[model samples]
Target: MPPKSNDIEAGQAIKRLPSNAELVPHAGKITMDEPAYFGKGIIKDLKTTVGTHWRQEMTNFNQKTVAVSMLMFITVIAPTLAFGASYSTATESHIGAIETILATAWIGCAYSFIGGMPLCIIGSTGPVLAFTTVLYDMSKNMDIPFYTFYAWVSVWMLIYAFLCSFFDLTRFVRLATRFTDDIFAFLIVSIFVIKAIGDPFGGVDGILFPFDPNHKTHQNQDADYDFLQVALLGVILGFGTTWLIFYLRSFKNSSFFCSDTMRSSIHDFSVTFSVLIWTIVSKVIFKDVEVASLNVPDQFEPTYQCCDDACTMFFPKECPDQAERAGVRSWFADMADTNGKGWVPIAAAGPAVLAFFLLYLDNGITWHLIMHKSNNVHHGEAYNYDLLLSGCFNFVNGLLGLPWLVATTVPCIVHLNSLAEKDKDGNILHVQETRLTMLFSHMCVGFSILALDLLKLLPLPVLNGVFLFMGVSALPGIQFWNRFLLFFQQPSKYPETPYTKYMDKGRIHLFTIIELFFFAMVFVVQNIKAVAVVFPMMTFFCIPARTHLLPRIFEGWELVLLDGDIFEIQEWIDRKTDSVAEYEASLRGDLSEYEDDATQ
Candidate 1:
């Protein structure tokens, strides 16, 4: 979904003197204090937006939808594909690119039609991959079937998601500041970077245990990969893909792109185009190397197996690597086989509760980032409602034995920027906001399930490169990263962002120091096996630190300048600038301080 087009222009537009015709922002058509859902003004928000976006799409269905759909088709599929491959490989589960595409396309389509925040792009993420992977390992050791245990976990996740909405825990999400958002954002992006650098298979883990293709022997779970022979190709393809992505993103501003339509098209299809070009290049240049390819099959098939002869045990060590996924049919598998006398599902609830907390934090903070005032998304926040809807979707995913989905950070950011139309000044004027683009983009993914073989043609290294590009693109926006740059940047030449405008340079340094500490803590916790399952809980720790500890350390104005919404910062800037002008007037002896004011 497109963000509000005026975001980039907001700072400048608000500076001009107020007039009747100058654009004025409306504080959403409906407002409700979310106190345990007591306000209950949900219908009011829904009614106001019923046809606003739909009408825009109807008016230019052929032109805009085609461009966005094409662009989204290219962008959406690769991540889901890559995520599917990674998740399945790590967990030894039946999840594949096709299933991932199915879920993403299906759930995203439903969300677009009715979900409140269209800007939030949904997909499986690094945390959930880690979450599910750990669960699978646990169930296997305990002799519980993975999917059966997964089904129970899914039930608990949905229940908790609904519980979160019902009790108004949704309100806590609003309290997230840049302090917490950057920490999680950094964590998500780094998964890509670390994965690519550490292993040819992807992720921070440096090894992959390949199995015998002939299916003749027991594959060692600890088998180590020697990527050094093909590592050079990985580096070349990865960096090349990354460069193409960065180049294409900035290409919209290039003179060569010329017309708006051309630039828009390039911007929309940049990721897909970059991936395709490099993939072809890798095939031609590295044909001699036995590099990894995507695990996508040519047609729909079961990623897992189910049979009367199947061993009912969770992950039998006697079973070969492929045989673990060889038990179930591609379409459906019942949980009754592994629920372990109805008590396992009950016990699974404890871990399910933990997973739901992470899901809640990740989803909430992502929504916070996308809907940040600076992003200029004008729609009302439906925290409670969206949470409930996600629970329904996840419950369905559990039943189908598919990967659970969450709001992916980079994709959502990319989606918003693509749908925007910038002015000569390069600030967004307005977005061509419509659900059709999202709907159509996802529809293409659903249709592409049968074409998985085509995706396999591209070497897996190229996909790794795409991941690197995604990680790098997300780095600049992080507050801690920007703040860290100050150590090398000369003080007088600091960038004129809100933090610089209203925060003392030294205080900003201290603020980032505190944030950096949080980032390091979460990173350590997520990577450490003992604490990884509770990573989201560790991430949630930032909220209380900001809410309680930070206030005691920094003054109210400093916190506002550093962490407040755009309007709040602008208000502080206005007052401080006025005070500075008055001080300058006193130095010039133009007027007494006792007077109302004098020109600077």
Candidate 2:
């Protein structure tokens, strides 16, 4: 019999029907005959679980396949070409460039592949490259052994990285706002522009001097001609490659292959192919182009001895004994100098600590924003864990006396979002599932790096094309007009999320404009570092100037509109104070009475 509606609601519900009892029983008695059927069902589910998920993920991964491939190429291959060229150009030795490339590639494979944050292409970054250049210069000036110092620094960096992971230091990423990310990104773009533009000109003083009419052509002919040729070729290729990747990836869709996986991969590949091809072509066309090669003194022969047909350190090689060899101006001098018995060094612990923290904040914020765009995604809680892994990797690289690595902004975001799926409400679906492909890619990179000869065949121009593309791709983020209006006047339209009445997209928009403007200044004026000082000062003045003066100029009621909207502001304040009022008050009671009277 059916229960009355009142009885059901009042908690006097009737017993289950006979049909319902058949469908679901309170208890069951296990029978030996039923074991086979239950076992089959369990086995079937287990077998199908991985298979079902994998198909969807692969389909998603391939959607934006071309773009993803291009990004990978740009991230990995383009830098490989640039590093080789830069080292050769700077040192007049191809071997150093080659060795660094080999080492970086070997390490980068682990970073690019095993790293938890997908789309972060690992290789020689701008700062790390700059540091390497510094190391090289210091080595030349001080007459110190290069490889030994490198090894020493590498060992210590590993120790530092391990400590970072053990302590779980990635928790600080939560405070990082769009402001911090933009600052770092602005800096990164500035650095890239500086290096790209400055490298060709050879610094501030040398730009017009060599090209002056009165200069003797015989003395400077080879050097000037070579510099111009390399510069022109590299710029065209790097920029072109970067552009192609961005162009291909922009054609996003809800269907398969347009998703995160392929889009990012294609973008990487475009960069890689651009760079790699240029390198190969450079070698072929300008045999006298005097480009660099990686062949160097074998690590095993001079530093180690062959024992039973395998390399083994003979003596005083890995860790040299006595003071004379220890203090050489290599990257590892910091470690030896720490004990109070080594050579003169630059800013020690403070700069490195600050640099690491800045890098963490910069990467974490950008990653969070990009990750949020994905349909299927994990919450930011896992960011700490992932960042810990990245930091650990960086620390390990540092110990190798290698350059400290970082998680890049664009690639990481593009990779994850392209791979994500969305539910009916447009919420992101399963994201953690992309781990399989990431693992496979890492394995590929690791094995590929061992073939140093094949890697050397890559060209520089293609890489340049890719570099230019990446820089150009970031331009859209600038939002110049939108930023200008927000900066000068009260925002007519403001971004809003459900929890907050108003959100500031202006920070990012302004930062991007500032970054592009800085890049342009560096390109044109050729003295970018001068702007760094200017930026901090401007930020200081603008923030204070607006906060204090703007409030006074506008009335309290006007201020509400200026900040957001009056109703929205009041609603937020009321909700926040709902639990905190000392005295009970019915502020909305009067309004409710008016509404009731109006209805009557």
Candidate 3:
């Protein structure tokens, strides 16, 4: 009798295995052919990396790049200013807005031309900020010049970075499973969300409605100057910006749009359009109301204004009356000004070691997430090369007394998503991989120093909305977040992912619970200033927990189902099928032997 149609189809499907070349290396596995020691790995990386360096920028230049550039300009600048302000408080204005802008511009420009992954946006992060604050406190306690000690630490860090790159130590980044990436990504998203709507219920310093509740109205005060009206208008602008962007983004699929191209254009330029519209609304339409604007420097100068001869290494002296204090510090940091402590340079290595690990984990994990198979980024990764570049840039930044920069998680995710070409269902078809957006956006940041007045017109609430949008937009693609939402969902109506289809519901929730625990630990540690310098080390610990500890709790197949990428899941399924076939064949042989003995 002939086989049934379904049987034939199943047989054909079983015969069709994916080619070896088609398999994507699992995130938790190291599959590179280059030798780990010496410079061979770097050489191999550069062969693919250097060749495509120019093509990434020159090819695929389009209108989307321009829109993305403007969008990213706002995205990158807002955080730069925000972090810069934090640094001013943390480091006593040594690394302020101008320093951050300069570092971002110069480093961004250099990396665009030479970086292995141009899409990864480099900026200062919270962990780095926390570490800097700790280092400053240490410097004060030791009675040493902060910038001088900072410069020596960076010098040692540079050496360590080069050595790591040379030895291909960055290959360990492959051990960062989705478990780690999701937690890190979520942490960044949480930061954005919190910063956007800080104590919106009552706090006067809230970003959404920063009206002082303590203000008492005087008889001479203008009746039009109502704090309630100002607060309400600010809320409108903030939420209005977020709503407009999301509405326009959805307009591409809306039936009201006449042309698909027009709808798509509006969607692509949604962020830029929203920002411009809200800025005009705040500055022009509601000119009478005083909303908080972006705090930018009035001139292109150092934030710590002091006359050159007035300030000493240990104690800052009062500035001379009527003298320009902007150029007090020189471009180069004085490493020798260590308050007569000859052992300072040698002792700097201790902090340098911590900074190295911090940068390594920060840069490595972010690159791994960005290069994940789902993102559809075809451009090759340059983990070793990019690390080297970061070390080099940070070395320069440190010498110039600027805050250290690394691959900022939120901004990089935002940049990647912005350039991605997605379908109606939000699957990435292609990312418009280009250097132009990073190059252009950062250049605008550099130029903004001259146009600080223009930037001041942009209300802080509008940026808060942008921050809210960024955090919300990034949430859709995170698998952990999707699984997290499943906790609230009915099992019968659960979305049918591989894990859902194969694994038990209880098992799925257990895996999520474990991941949540790790995330919570990292979050708690990061918030506690006394132990926050260990943030990167704690983040790196997830690798061992995923690789060694997770296996004991879940079966191999279950782990693959829950945490593995698309390719890993497919491979695991194939292996399981083969094992089942072999087991069934052995049972048939045993049964045949028993039947022969019975016949005898």
Off by over 4 Å in 2: 1-67, 84-95, 98-108, 111-114, 130-169, 189-401, 410-459, 477-600
The alpha-carbon deviation from the true structure for residue 558 of candidate 2, after best TM-score superposition, in angstroms, is: 13
What do the candidate models score in CA lDDT, each in turn? 0.69, 0.41, 0.80
Tens-digit lDDT track of model 3 for 59-137 = 6678888889999889988888888887887787777888888888888878887888889998888788888898888
Candidate numbers sorted by TM-score from highest down:
3, 1, 2
Screening candidate 1 with a backbone cut-off below 3 angstroms (N, C-alpha, C), the clashing residue pairs are 5-430, 5-431, 195-203, 302-330, 305-326, 305-327, 305-328, 306-327, 306-328
* Candidate number of the best lDDT: 3
Q: TM per model? A: 0.80, 0.51, 0.87
Could you tell me which 10 consecutive residues in candidate 3 have the lowest summed lDDT?
Answer: 13-22
Residues 313-370, model 2: lDDT tens digits: 2223443552233222223224443233254233233334434443444455555445
For every model shown, the clashing-pair count is: 9, 90, 0
TM value for model 2: 0.51
Better of 2 and 3 by lDDT: 3
Runs of candidate 3 exceeding 4 Å displacement:
1-35, 199-206, 209-225, 307-310, 313-327, 573-600
TM-score: which candidate is best? 3
